[model samples]
Target chain A: MSRLTSVAGSTRAIRATHKTLSSPWATAGAIVIAALWTLPTFGLFLSSFRPAEDITTSGWWTFFAHPRVTLDNYAATLTATSGITVPQALINSLTITIPGALIPITVALLAAYALAWIDFPGRHLLFVAIFAMQIVPLQMLLVPLLRLYTGGLTVGGVAIFPGFAANSMSDGFAQVWLTHTMSALPLAIFMLHNSLSAIPTEIMEAARIDGAGHGRILRSIALPLAMPTVASYAIFQFLWVWNDLLVSTIFTTGKNAPVTKILADLAGMYGQQWHLLTAGTFLAIIVPLIVFFALQRFFVRGLLAGSTKG
Target chain B: MQAFFSWLASLPNIVQVPLVIAAFLVVVAVIIVLIEVAPRPGTAYTWVRAAIAIGFPVIALAVFGLEAGAAWVFGLGAVLGGGLFWLDARSTKGRGRLIQLALFVSPALLLLIVGLVYPTIKTIVAAFMDKTGNQFIGLDNFVWVFSAGGNGGLISLINTVVWVVVAPVAATGVGLIYALWVDRSRAEKLLKVLVFMPMSISLVGGSIIWKFFYDYRQGNQIGLLNQIVAWFGGEPVNWLQHYPLNMFLLIVILVWSQTGFAMVILSAAIKGVPVELVEAAQIDGASSARRFRHIIIPSIRPTIIVVWVTISITSLKVYDVIAVITAGQNSTSVLGYEMVRQFSLMPPQSGHSAALALLIFILVIPFIAYNARTLKRGN
Candidate 1:
């Protein structure tokens, strides 16, 4: 009777310990890390709202004691006497980003279709070659491509592509489109090919029996099924192009430069003006965040769909 | 008609750009016409059918004289012919078999020859040429890169090594830990979003934010980080100007940006670790820590390798952080930044830039090969 009683007591004690230790600690720890991770962006957001004097004088957190908000920084950024406006820069960013995002997806889709479904001689070799190109650092290609662009794709003006002179070409929206498209091609092909290949072969064969040619099969079957992945990749590529400053800076100059380049210039030229810089940075982020939330459903589904399954 | 032709001609490069596009479009239109008129073949069109199938681009180029500029006109013609081979994909076809074979492989062959194979060969040749690309330098630039006391020889090498070693390991480790810890939590989604928020900020924006955090001054504290230090009765330090640590600081920016990717990938892998295995471990008297080490780690090893190598390749090409933050000052130079600096900023020293670039390529090639091999094995 005493032994039975001891066993019951120990069982109750273990259950009680498990209950006390498990739930609250995990919840609390997750909350803490989440807060820490988000704090810098939050700080920047708050700092952007405050006036320049208030920001320089005190921390963003100090605004709780004396909350003074103003739109003067944004107003200046919009209609400055220096003449390059925020809205105009934003339009420039869109011009680069829209095409930059689209060209790769279109090209990659076709290439991926050919790679996944279409069997031909040297197909495997082609896939391997394109995949290998992914590791050729983007920076390495900058000079060679730039030189090619300027010198008419030739050796010492002996025309490789006559009338396509690099020096004659201007830094504008066109440059952004070309550079982003070329750079995006390899990864786009690799990623889309994987997603495309995951599609069951039997379904494609069935379509073929239904009298659908390769183009018809691609249109009626593969394209629709691959939409979610394509959309997700499009979002990823869009966000990348939207947020990319380095590529834009390299490919574009003068008035055609995007908001990212402008933000860099703002920080460099007017480091003291955190209020303005913060506002500018926030402006740049707004579109991307909107895009993120808009595509959140497709985003999560697409990410898991491509990487995890086949 | 004249107005339209003039407009087309004036749009861009008449020879390579516009004419090629025009020819390509015409070929596409013609293919659509053919599909409308010609009987559809069974077995999804053979090689010949496929070539003719996609021959629009080639037809467009040839019709508009775009192919005239290229050295591979005959190759283009052969590609256009290959489209006819699509009909002969099967031996039972009534069309000429020889014509079918030649036609089927033509477009891909032409595009490969003109678009890709030619340019790559040309780039290789350019790498060997002098500044004006007038004469061969005979590996002079490659020699300079490895030679002692060459400009950008040591700092770039050391910085690149530090980056490749430190960034990947740190990013992957932190990412793995975070993914493991957060895998089961209620706020897992929110945590991921917060981590990923940095990814939305353009590299330039992150650079600005970090620049503020590391903003230096001798007299007073204006930056957020410096102000916090002053609040703690500490002195403000020039974070970006400080050597060795500054490189690590730059690496932190990459870590922040890339951790989301690592976590997302590893988190998926963790979720994939079969629930039965964990239960099995528990029944065998394994503690939570032991379960993680044995069950979780072993199951996700492949994913860990993937994340590690992918991040390593990215690190090899890390330029923006170093460029925007330090601009290769205070000995924080890496290969990617040095390439830009030497070629674009410095007086067009293509040789040195190309050499530095080649080194980066050589280093990355082995990792890429390993990745490809592992992927092949996995598949």
Candidate 2:
């Protein structure tokens, strides 16, 4: 008891000393780093809201010099002008993203349940194969897919499922969905499996014994419990699909391209309206932010849920 | 040639239909059977599952012919489907098992097989063949990956090595220092948000941001960094056109974007470091630096490993930043960009590109293996 008391006393003294030593340095370092990290993003935000000419002529910090702000960049980015428009690109992005996000979540949930709870033959081997595919560079798959989508035939004249059309149904949101779904699978499966496995076995068994049935248990117990994770992965996939350039660029051609592709195209327009790219980028980020912040409570938990436990 | 032709002939008739609707069902069924029989042989349904697995593919082969019999093609698909089916079946009961599985997994699977898996197999096989994707070429393409300078071919391998080394280490170091400094501060949340802010920007946006920073001038300067240099009476350099320096600039963008990921995760681990342990160390007369090294670093070591390996894999696979920022020109070609350049975007060196991609996969395996091991052990 005397030793315990002494230890407690020492701990208190140590804590007090740590507080003294740490408070100022930690606070000062935090402030500096925070400013450094945020300044560039702030610059980006300011640039997006500024006129194109002002952006080209001065740093974003010069916004205070003008004493006023205008929405010309935003207006230019949103409206159809000179064969480019932000609103149309946004629509194209949504058409691509909604299905792109939905497909992987649905598939991974199903795959995760099996990997976690189901007793099946070759389960480990199949799991290994799925995991192995994670390393396969996504770029390696693009051409073959494009080939398959455009000119691929199993043997006869029957079109492959992702085949745009034998002649006319080519180059649109349909191709983006196909591309996004493939890339999202390995990671999605890995994530959902982690979460599903964490669920107590007894809960599943209890549902099984009560004649709750697999479908019913999944609906009532698993799905509801896993709601936060499903939402998180949905956001991640949505953001990834939205932010994608290469896959979208590869799969979709011309006007059917998503905003990222359009942004790249805007870049090539030789600084005629480079400010639109900034505005477009900001506009593009809003959906992801909404998805992320609205689900922030679940974001960290969802990301880390499958990776570790205690 | 004859044996290969015979093997091709044996694939099945569904190949003739182009769509392979029946083949898909049969393949899916075979997959379910393969999955069902693999995990728990103790289960009562093992033989039934095995029979279904063996039966469908065989029947599909017989009914359709080997011309379409590439189960190797469906092997990955079946595994994916089977895994989903088994999961659905486990949680499911009664008559609608197939329907529920189809509804839940098919939306993704149908697109995935067509988009990712099928094309991957096609590329792998194409790698073994000539550039036209006709006539088997064996190890010739693999040879070209190591050959001398030709259209930025083998140079990609070196550039990729440089990327794998530089980006992750720099990102982790900066993140660790930042995380350690910011851990208990009042501004922690704001600091993390700022660090993490870049994550919200797309790859091209990040490129544009840096492009402005590295913007060059003939004599006077307009860009931020160049202007600062001009203030010091220094000459403005075309930052993107320099060889190693250009590559380093590209690395800075990736490191900047990724550091926040490392910081956030490491911050969690740093917080997880017990207060009692640090207090104990302090009582034992450890300095702040010593306490950090002994107590905090040791505690968060597992997380550091995880972050490092994760970043390593990502750095190896990164393409977009380099693609957008430098277009893999100026000797900045890494494997990801080069693979795209050789195989898809440029003249399509399908074989050499596949070989290069395979090399990346080889390099990444040890890190991934280590990550998986650590993850399992940590759990």
Per residue, candidate 1 scores C-alpha lDDT tens digits across B153-208 of 66888888999899889888877877766655656678788876675666777776
Give the winner by TM-score.
1
- CAPRI tier of model 2: acceptable
Q: Could you say which candidate leads in DockQ? A: 2
lDDT of 2 by residue, A157-200 (tens): 33223244443335444456656777888878877776677688
List all candidate RMSDs to the true structure.
7.6, 8.8
Q: How do all models score by TM-score?
A: 0.83, 0.81
Off by over 4 Å in 1: A1-29, A80-83, A154-160, A163-166, A300-309, B1-129, B218-220
Q: What is the TM-score of chain A alone in each candidate?
A: 0.87, 0.85
Candidate lDDT (C-alpha), each? 0.67, 0.67
Provide fnat values for all models in the order shown: 0.22, 0.32
Q: Give the lowest summed-lDDT range of ten residues in model 1 chain A.
A: A157-166
Model 1 TM: 0.83
